[model samples]
Target: MTKALKASGFLGLAVMMAVGLHQFVILSGGSAVPPWMIGGHAHLGVLSILAIVMGFAVPALGVVGQLRTAVTGLFIAGQWGIPGIVWLGEGFGLTFLMPTGFLWGGALIASMLIMLYKTVTTEEAGGGGRAGVAPADD
Candidate 1:
């Protein structure tokens, strides 16, 4: 289960990086991205993937509770683009931007909140500490 989710998460991050850099190409070149993301794309794609995976998976392993807490922070940080790309369009007269503003942003925030509340406050949260604590605390 965890492995599946991790794989999915990695794949999702990869796709996000690809799409993100592709936007830059589509912006500057004014052409559809071709065989692959290169030139500007290669540099940004790799860097984006590296940063996301490191930030996403570091705390999401072995300890589900910690992962939940970490994900909430990551989810929030990931929204630095929200207002500029999302809210600005929505605030005045651009309703077309509503999807990006509400759908994506809301999903990210909601999922993170659920994961955090479930893990951080659950009974099993502290039990994982019992194995090592009994010896060290005494």
Candidate 2:
């Protein structure tokens, strides 16, 4: 799962770089950049970083098995889906698809929330409520 997340993150960054170059070309050609393009580029960059960071954080938080798989899937989907939907809708004037992007964003948020909950609830080896740190001996 960690590998998948990191791969997705790198792929997203690659796509973002391409989009950024496209934006640069548009600017150099003296045309104003479209708002959607700028927004999509930002989303792609930020989500890519999130996916990469979450890859390292997940295991430390003790996410495993099916839950880890599900979170990873959600992360990948959102990492692509939100910006893809934006580009499809605004780039092609397919306004109907815009609302659906929220669903993808929601999935990403939910995945993070799940990880936060798991981290908070996870018991350390010394029975501490926090993760990653054992309680000091009395």
lDDT of 2 at 13: 95
- Name model 1 segments beyond 4 Å from true: 1-4, 17-97, 124-138
Instruction: Compose the digit string of candidate 1's lDDT tens values, residues 1-138.
Output: 334334444654565576676567687987765423333234333434443554454345333565554554444333333433433453345656556646545645664566555556555534565565456564
- TM-score for each predicted model, relative to the true structure: 0.35, 0.87
The 10-residue segment with the lowest total lDDT in model 1: 35-44
Model 2 off-target regions past 4 Å?
125-138
lDDT of every predicted structure (CA atoms): 0.48, 0.91
lDDT of 2 by residue, 8-54 (tens): 99989999999999999999999999999999999999999989999
Q: How far out, in Å, is residue 4 in model 2?
A: 0.8
Residue 134 in model 1: lDDT: 50
